[model samples]
Each structure stands twice: as structure tokens, then as C-alpha cells.
Target: MAHTIDISVVPPPLKSDWNPPAPSGNSVSPLVERRLLPAGPAYLAHVKRAVHKLTFEEHDKHVEAENERLGLNGTGANGEDDLGVGDEEEPEDLLTLDAKEWKKQDHYAVLGLSHLRYKATDDQIKIAHRKKVLKHHPDKKAGIAGDSNDDGFFKCIQKAMEVLTNPERRRQFDSVDPHYEDLESEVPTEKQIKNTKDPQFFFKNFAPVFEREARFSRKQPVPMLGAYDASKQEVEGFYDFWYNFDSWRSFEYLDKEINEGSDNRDDKRYTEKKNKSERARRKKEDTARLRGIVDLALAADPRIKRIKQEEKEAREAKKKGKTGAANGLSAKQKEEEEKKKAKEEAKRKEEEDTIARAEAKKAKAAAANAAKKARRAARATEDGTPA
Candidate 1:
């Protein structure tokens, strides 16, 4: 039995008489009609409706097959011992289920959160979902089995992500806007709800939300690689904190203190000893690694050996006040000198501009005051007031 499905027909917009591109390839009935192209957004609508129809058809076949398998089609009717498979008409297909039945399995309720009765920030919804998932995840607890555990939690997360990310589905489901509007009204077309039940949708939706959260929330600066120089103290500090475990431990303690209402840990000596030993070990390892690399490179190249010998000889000559053509300045010294000069010039210009602006502002104020006094005196004489 096919239930009466209310399929509202929306006409093409009146402003432009554009036709959709004809369905391509060999086919009996071209899936999309060419008449509905002008309304570009509704193109997705047409596709979704087609998909829904196909899904319903497939579901109808499945129900019929199941009924046959269960002997519900009178195959073993009337006193036949059919092993309790019950010779009754198959329960109505999914399409036959009324709106009330559909409401029982609402996608929003599955997420363990209230359906939106009003607008809310995505963060609020996300927090609610996280709490719900944590409560329901069996791995986090114990003894719970089947759908109430990880599987159900994951399904709910997926559904919520799908419904929220798609503007059309959310608006329609939330009753903020009707799925079908007045045919001739100025109602904009919606993107059709996709039929994907895949987990990939969750990740795709999650990335956008994650990016939004990271962008708006003030986060500790992340250190980037290749930032090396005097001008990058903050960058170096960011990396230093990031690479050190103490920063992470401190953050964890702070979070615990905020949430749990206390922070009292008395084990200090052991922690200090452990941290100091770890740092010393790491530094020693790094030094050995660098030294091994240098030794390997020098053994592989005779030029490095000659260069070191020449450098040592040059330093000795310089100490003895014997100068040569290649001895004016080293690259490192020149770079440092240039940096110092630039810093001094920048500071000098800043101070000069500061004084200049201050003096100009003082002069302008004095001139304005003198002009105001003259205007007041002229006004007093003109009105024959006491002057």
C-alpha cells in the first residue's frame, strides 16, 4: 500500500526563461526535465526528490521480499505450522508510516539534544553533543552493549552533523521554514537534502566547525617551523613552550583547578628532579647527535679539513696584527652591524616624530585660544556689553 505523499510542485521562476541542460546518454526517460533550469538552486531539489522516489521504490520491493520470506503473503496461511513466522499482511512500508511515526525517530532527538525551538550558537549544540556522546560511549564506561554504546553515539553524531550543516534540511526540520512554500510566492529554492548515510559527511562537517572554533576563540599561539632570528622572540617562546611538557602539564592543572574547585599537589622535589634529569638527558643526546653528524661530514669531505686549518691560521695572523685583503669583516659581524644600525634608525625616527607631533599640537592649541579670545572681545563690543 503506497501512502499518499504530498509532493508539492514548484514552478520555474518568471524572471528568466532558462531551461536545464537535457539529460545526457542513452535513457528511456531523461531523469531531469529541461523546463526547471532557470531556478539554479532548485536543480538540487529536483535531484533529491528523484532520489527519494527511487529510495521509496527500493524500500517497497524490500518489504515485499521480506513478506514473502516470512510467509506473510498467504503461503502458509490457515492452521499451517510455519514455525511462528506469522501469516499476516506485512506491516506498512516506510512511506506508509504517518508523520507521527516518523517523528518518533527524529534525527535531532537521536543526537540526545532538543530540536531547535529557537536559534542557538553552534558551540552550545556541540557542547551538548560532546556531553551526550561521553555519557553514552561504552568505552568510557562499562557493561552497556549494542546500540546504546559507541555505534548509536556515532550514528547520532553523524545525523546531527548532516542535518545541521545542510541549511535546507535544518530549516525544514526545525519548522523555521516549510519544506514546500506557496508555488507563486517569492520563496527561494532550497538545496535538496542529500541521501548520503556515509561517515565522510561527519568529518567534512566537523572540519568547518573546527576551523570556526579555532578562528574565533583566543588560542595559545602555535609555533611554526623556520622562524629563526632576533626579531622572533615570541615565536621562539611559543616553540619553547610547545616543545616542553611542563606547559601542557600546567594547562591540565589549571583546567582541573577551574573545574574541580581546588589545586593542591605537594609532590615538588620528585617532579623537579625528574624534569631536570629529562632535560639534561635530552641536551646531552642532542649534543652527541650534532657532533656525530659533524664528524661524518668532515670525514666525507677533505675541503672541510683544509677550510678549518685555513681559518685557524687566519685567526692567529689577525691576533698578531697581520692583516690581509680577505680580513675586513666576517659575514656574521656584518649582519649584526646592519641589524643594530637599522634598530637605532628606527628608534631615532620614532622619537623625532613623537616630539614633532607634540610641539605642533601645542602651537595649534595656542593659536586657537588667541583666536577665540579675539572673537569674544569683538562680540562684546558689537553688543555694547561690558568690554
Candidate 2:
């Protein structure tokens, strides 16, 4: 037996235009009439004047039919199969495209042009856009090229016009254009570094590594390298920046075990210990790897030696010019010079003393740790437990 519950409907006190209108013989309803477009063979023509979205069946049927016509086995269309199988070009043209890679295709390809993207004048691009608009526009699609192609490709052409026509968007697109070949890889690889020529090429090509690392931090951006003619301070700063590079890499994802649900305290502690050791090891490896790269760059650099020699030559020239001159060092100047030399000597001695103390301290700590370990081992032996 079926149980039924009484449901009551309440009418509003006042009927406004917000309420649905009474049923009508008219095919288009009055209430949502503004939300729709004029009746067309395809529904999307008047709404957004863009691509017609197809249901799974409709899309599949279209693809299957196209495959049959092109004598393809439905893997996907290839350029050999048809002139419109543009998918292969997209990946080859963009290796590091951010998102929706298929959607952000080559604007030139979208407009069905070649070799004129960066060189094409705005008027020429506009003219080409208009011609394409006239050719494949949905308004003219029916009866002209009916069912031969969807509105998607034409919409891409329209989008290409918008992107290629605007100066700023065009600049951004061009920056990531795979054809630029400014740096062959998104991040410099070992091969790229080995193949790189001089400091200029090294600085520019290695920038992508810093850029990749930059996404790890909010406070820092990748440091721009100084030119070979940079001032002493700027050169020092560039070196210091790389020397103190803080990588944001972590090995948390590589944990052998995770302390998730159903783990006891011992299990949790074991997992934590494993993760800690792994993180420390990874950090050490990263620091050493970075230091090695920086060292390689420094050794390969041709500027540092020149800068030092230039400074030395300037000092020697000044000394020779000043010797026995009317403005030669006074007695007071001589005293000040002696004091400065003495102060520098004292500072050097102090730094040496500090280094010696640090080394001694480290040695002492190691000795203490060794003694402690030995004692622990002895105790473990006495207790008959694993050391």
C-alpha cells in the first residue's frame, strides 16, 4: 500500500511580473522571453554569437562521421588526414602554456595566416579578421557550409582577432610564444648550461630556474643579474643574491609513511623521524646542488677577474701620480693611514680567532657526542637490549 501526504500550495498575496505568466499558446513564453535569443536553426547564434555546445552523442556522432570521411581510425585527426587537424601544432608551439592549452591556440593559426603575426600591421590584421568573420560566421554558416564545420573554429578566429589586435594581450602572448626561442627550455637543464656560451647567455638562460623557484615564495622575486660593466657594489650584490638563494623545494610528498588515521604514538613518532631525516637530507642536497651551480657560473664568468684587475690598475695609477707631488700625504694623513692599517690587521686577527673558536667548539661537541654514544652502547649491552 502507498502512503499519501497532503500538500497545500499557497498563492502570493499580490501577483507581480516576477511570477510565471499563465499558460499560453505562443511557443515562446512571456516571463523568460528576455533570457532567450530569436529562433534560429542553431540556438547559440543570438545569445553569445559563439560556439554551439554539443551533447556527448551529437559530438561523438560528428567526430565519428568526420573520422569516416577522413578515413581515420578515430585516434584523432592528423594533419595528413585533414587540413583542420590543428591539435598537433598547439603542443609543439607551446611547451609551457599555463592552463586550458587547447583553448589558447596560436592566434595566427586561428586566423589561418602564416609568418605575419608579429610583423602584421593592425589594419592588415583587422582586414584579415573581417574576411574570416564573413567567411565562417554562423549567420552565413547555414546553406553556405552547412554541417561541414562547427562554430568553434570560427569563434577561435574571433578570439584570435581580439587577442592579436590588442597591444598588451599580444605582448603577453608573444612573451610565451614558443617560437621566441629566447631560452630553449622553461627552466635551464644541465645540457643547456653546459652548452651555454658566455656570462650573458648564462645569466639570461638560467633565469627560468629562479623563476620556477620564485613561485615558492611571496616575499622574493628572481634576482636579475647585473651586467659586466656594473658597479662594484652591484656585482657584489649579484653574487651575494645567488650565494644566499633560498629554495622553496620540499620532499614532503616522498614520505615513506604518513601519520594519518589509526596510527599509534610509536608509529607517529617513527613516521615523523623518517620525514625529518628525509627533509634534512633533501635540504643538504639542494644547498650543495645550488652551491655547485653558482660555483660553476663563477668559474665560467669572465667579468670578475677583469673587474679586480681594473680596480688594481686604478689604485696603482693613483699611487704613482700622487708620489712626491705637492699634495702628497701630510703627517696627519700618514698617521691616519697607519691607524687604518692597524685597525684592519686587528679585525683580520679577530676574525681568525673567531673561526678557530668555532672549530674548537665543533670538535668538542663531536667528542662529547662520541663519548655519549659509547656510554649508551655500554648501557645497552648491560641491559641486553639492541643498541
Clashing pairs in 2: none
Best by lDDT: 2
Candidate 2 lDDT over residue span 1-387, tens digit each: 999999999986874646776898868746754566467635443343334566656666876787677665213223342232222233332333332333346776665455555666776676566656766677775766434443666666767788788876675465444343333235455666678665577667555555444433324655555456777777677668778876555655345655448558888888789888987897687678667766766765557777889989999988878775635557669889999999999999999999999999999999999999999999999999989
Query: How many backbone overlaps does candidate 1 show?
Result: 0
Q: Tens digit of lDDT per residue, candidate 1, span 1-387?
A: 888989999997666777777987886865875664345635554565577764656756755786677674224335333332211222223212233233233444444343332243455455545554655454665564543335444555555556655655554354322211121132111221144454344334323322322221224553322212223355345334433412111111111112233343443545555666665564465345334433332243233344567779889988766444335556668889999999999999999999999999999999999999999999999999965
What is the lDDT, from 0 to 100, of the residue 262 in candidate 2?
53
Per-residue lDDT value at 126 in model 1: 56
Give the Cα lDDT of each candidate: 0.46, 0.63
- Report the Cα lDDT for candidate 2: 0.63
Q: Each model's RMSD to truth, in Å?
A: 36.7, 36.8
